[model samples]
Target: MIKGIYETHVNVRNLENSNHFYEKVLGLAHAYGQPERGNSFYWIGGERHAMLGLWEKEPAQVQRQHFAFHISLEDMKHAVEYLENKGIATRNFHDDDTGELYVFGWMPAVSVYFTDPDGHSLEFIAVLPDEAKPELGLIPWSEWERMHGRGV
Candidate 1:
C-alpha cells in the first residue's frame, strides 16, 4: 500500500554546501547526518511526509536528476518570486530562465523549475482543478488560464 514517495537520494559534490542549500535556503529539516559516512538526511514538508538523502561524491560521480514538490495552487502562483527573492533563479520546463510558471495541460498542473547548487533539477508544482487538455501539451500559465476560462 504505497501512499507516496517516502525518500529519494541524490549525489552531491560537497556535502556541506548541499546541506546549506537544503537546510538553510530551502528550509528542509536536517533529519540526521554522518559526515564520516559522507551522507546526510533531510525531512521535507515536515518530519515524515518525505525524506531526502544526500551522498557526498566526487563531482564526476554525481548524476543529476529531477523531482518536484507538491504545493498549493496559491503558493504555486508566487513560487517564482519567492524563489527568486531568495536568490534562486527560476525557469520553465524548457530550461529557459523565464521566471514564470508553465502549465502541462495534459496533467493540468502548473509548475516552476529551479536547480539545487549541484545542478539537480527541482520543482515546486501544484495540480490545477480542471479537466485534462492533452492537446494543449505544455504552455504558459496565462494561456492555460485563458483556455480554461478562468483568465486572470
Candidate 2:
C-alpha cells in the first residue's frame, strides 16, 4: 500500500541555477545528489524524508506541472509576502471574476501560487479546520479573513 510520496523528479536546464532557486527561493535543503548524472536532490520535509529531485538536461523540456507544499496559515501569508518582495507573481482561483493572490472559502484551504525556475506551478497551501471551511464557491483570502474577523 502507498503511504505517501517519497519524492518527485523534474528536469531543469541548469542544475546549479535550479539548485540555487530551490535552496534560496524555496528554502529547501540540498540533499546528496549524483553530480555525475547531473542531478541534484532537495529535502522537502527533512534531511532524509520527502524530497524533490532536479535532473539537468540539455534543451530542457519541462511540462508545466502543479504541486503544493503544505504550510501553516501564517507561513502561507509570509510566503506570499516573501515572493512579492522578490517580485515573483502569484495567482489564485476564486469563484469571483476578479483575479487575486489567494484562494479561500473553498477546498478548506488558502493557497498562494507561483512558478519555479523551470515554470512549474507551485503553491503554498494551508488547510483550515473543518468548522472554518466554507460550503461552496471560492473567495479571496482578504474577503474570507474580513468575513471571519481575522483581518489582513
Candidate 3:
C-alpha cells in the first residue's frame, strides 16, 4: 500500500537563497543533496523521514506553484504571525463565500495562502472532516481522531 508522500521536488534559481528560506524561515533541516545533480534537499524530521527537494533552475524556468502544510489552528495562527513579521502578508485569509478559504479552481480545503520571500505560494491548510458531525463542525481538533482515523 502507498503509505504517504516521502518528498516533493521544486525547481529554484538559487540554492543558497532557497536553502536559507527553507532552513531558517521555514525551520526545516538541511538534508542530503548534490549541486552537480542540480538538486538540494531538506526535511522536517530527520534522515529517517521523507524530504523536500529543490532543484536549481533559471528564474524564468521556475514555474509558480503552491504547496501546503497540514497544521492546527494554533500553529496556523503562529505561522501567519511569523510570515507577517517576516513582511509576508496573506493574499487572502478567512473563510470565503463558499465556506472555504482560497477555494480557487481545483483547490478544496480550508487554507491560508501566502508567499515565501522568493514569491513561492505557500498554504497552511486544515482539511474539513469528511463527516460533519455536530461536534466536528468548525471545532478544531474536536474530531481529529475521526478525521485522521485514529483509534482512541
RMSD of each: 1.5, 2.8, 6.7
Q: Is candidate 1 or candidate 3 better by lDDT?
A: 1
Clashes of each: 0, 0, 0
Instruction: Give the TM-score of each candidate.
Output: 0.92, 0.83, 0.67
Would you list the C-alpha lDDT of every candidate in the order shown? 0.89, 0.77, 0.64
Name the regions of candidate 3 deviating beyond 4 angstroms. 45-47, 93-109, 127-130, 133-152
TM-score of 2: 0.83
lDDT of 2 by residue, 26-145 (tens): 789988889899999889878777999899887547676778888887787677678878777776654233545454555678887788887888888888654555564676677777
| Best first by lDDT, ranked | 1, 2, 3
Model 3 TM-score on a 0 to 1 scale? 0.67
Q: After superposing candidate 2, which stretches have Cα over 4 Å from the reference?
A: 94-99, 104-106, 132-134
Ranked by TM-score from best down, the candidates are 1, 2, 3
User: Which whole-number lDDT from 0 to 100 does residue 15 have in model 1?
Assistant: 97
Q: Which ten residues in a row have the lowest lDDT in candidate 3?
A: 99-108
What lDDT is reached at residue 27 by model 3? 78
